[model samples]
Target chain A: MAKKKTSLYREFVKGLWDDNPVLRMLLGLCPALAVTNSAINGLAMGMATTFVLLSSSIIISLLRKVIPHQVRIAGYIVIIATFVTVADKFLAAFLPEISKSLGPYVPLIVVNCLILGRQEAFSSKNNVGRSILDALGMGTGFIFVLVVLGGIREILGSATLFNLQILGDWFNPWMIMILPPGAFLTLGILIGLGNWLNERKVKV
Target chain B: MSLLLLFLSAAIVNNFVLTYFLGICPFVGVSKRVSSAVSMGMAVMFVMTITAAVTWLIYHLLLVPFKIEILEYVSFILVIASLVQLVEMFIKKMSKPLYDTLGIYLPLITTNCAILGLALFSVLREYSFIESLVFGIGAGAGFTLALVLMAGIREELELSNVPKPFKGAGITMIVAGSLALAFMGFAGLI
Candidate 1:
């Protein structure tokens, strides 16, 4: 019983860092790259994604047995698309500004490999409790990375963090930092830094 | 002339992979070698073209007429999935060698956001049927261009002494970043 409990805990913890959906696993790169132009957008995108991920995980865990093997992928996608629609409508209705900024990206989340990958790999096999934990862990990890990435870009590009002026008036903002290339460059270096840290820990 | 502008803009000025970040999965996953990258790019282009035509028809003919645009995501995805399966089967039956070359990536196209993004963008822009077809070809060409460029760089990157941690995805991203910057030159043209 203790061993089983520990393994379940391991599953949740792994996603936090070891198998982080973005930095480590590299799933769902599109949203991670596109929406992180500003800290607020990134944070909103992350939470919305978390909501969809959590809800979908719970539902898929319950329906694991019912969905047959042949059409499982399509089944998972339908479930995901339904949640994505809900998320999209919720954002557009309640948070119009964020919705406008996120634009089609919210709907595009339907194709996010992270959520589908989790369904096929973890949620489909695990019980509801474990699947929820895994989803929360992965979602939180995804949110953390997005917030950090957003902060970096915002601070550099606009001399702000979460819409606050962190940098001094004298600080020259790098316009390119908020541009498309900046997302790729910042994420690349971050991934490299992550790899270096992991290697150091392993070596020690 | 308008179609030419659309083609140029979609293909270079605003690349799907670099500018919009639509197809980063295949961009990163299948971009190791130029040959495979070309094959993958071709496969994606073919699918994107068909997806655009079909989705446009469905959206204009069915969804708009019915007033149930809310079903856009669900219906579009289902259409894309079936289309990919159909394309896969058709290819397998028609040409074994081509099917073998595409391998798993053919099926993976169903999940590639580039195709869906193309569909969504075409709808959002209210593109006419001919314009949507042009847009699809342009987007696919852009995706292929980016992928092939990245693959070529990566092929040469094999010899260089990259830092240990930045060996794989990390370095590829930086290369892509620079390529994006270069591609930005086209932004002025359009």
Candidate 2:
């Protein structure tokens, strides 16, 4: 019994850094790279994604037995899309600006492989509590990376962090840091850095 | 003319993968080789085109008429998920060779945000049926264009000695950044 509990803890913690879906596993790089120009965008996107992931994980875990093997993927997507719709509407009606800024991305989360990946790989096989924990870990892992990228881009691009200017007047903004290419560049380097770290760990 | 502008805009002026950063998953994951990138690009284009046509019809015709636009995200994703599965099965039976070429990428398309984004964008922009189809195809072409170019460059890059900090993804990103800048030149087109 103790061993099972400890193993559950290990699964939860693994997603934080070691098997991070964003930086390490590289499963859900689409949103991690985009929609993170500012800290606020990153936080909002992260939270919204977390909410969807949590709900979908719970539901998929609960339905694991009944879902037909042939149609499990579709079943997972339908569950995810339902929650994503809820999250999207909740944001649009409540937080219009963030909704507008996120644009189609909020809806695009429906197809985000991370959520589906977890369902097919982890959630479908685990119990509800373990699935929720794994989802939380993965979601937080994703948010950590987003906030870092958003901080870098926002600080460098606008001389601001979290919407507050931090640089002096003489400082010139690296205008491209927050642009589309900047996103790719930031994520690519981050991925490289992640690889470097993982390689060092392996060497050790 | 307006439709043409949409095509030009989505394809080059504002590429989904390059400019909007919608589909970076496939962009980086599959762009290692030119042949795979081209095949993946073709698959995306094919599915995206079908998704746009179907989603547009469902959204404007069925959902809008019924005043249940709230179902947009749910319904669109569900349709896309099943459609991708159906395509995978059909291809396996009808064209085993093409299925082998596409490999795992066929089902992976369901998770490509660019596909969903195309559908959502079509609805968001209030595009008509034909307009949505054009937008879908254009987005796919743009994704293919960007992926193929990156693959071609990376193929050559394997032989080149890049700087340390920018060795792998860093330099790839910097190159993409510059490429994005170059693509910005197409702003004047259409």
DockQ of each: 0.84, 0.64
Encode model 1's per-residue lDDT on B63-147: one tens digit a residue: 9999989999999999899888988898899978878877877777888989889999999999999999999999999999999
Candidate 1's C-alpha runs over 4 A off are B93-103
Tens digits of lDDT, candidate 2, B40-100: 8987888899999999989878998899998888788888888888888887898787788
State how far residue A179 of model 1 sits from its true place (Å). Answer: 0.2
Best by lDDT: 1
lDDT of 2 at B165: 46
Of candidate 1 chain A, the 10-residue stretch with the lowest lDDT total is A7-16
| DockQ of candidate 1 against the true complex | 0.84
Q: Model 2, stretches more than 4 Å misplaced?
A: B94-97, B161-174
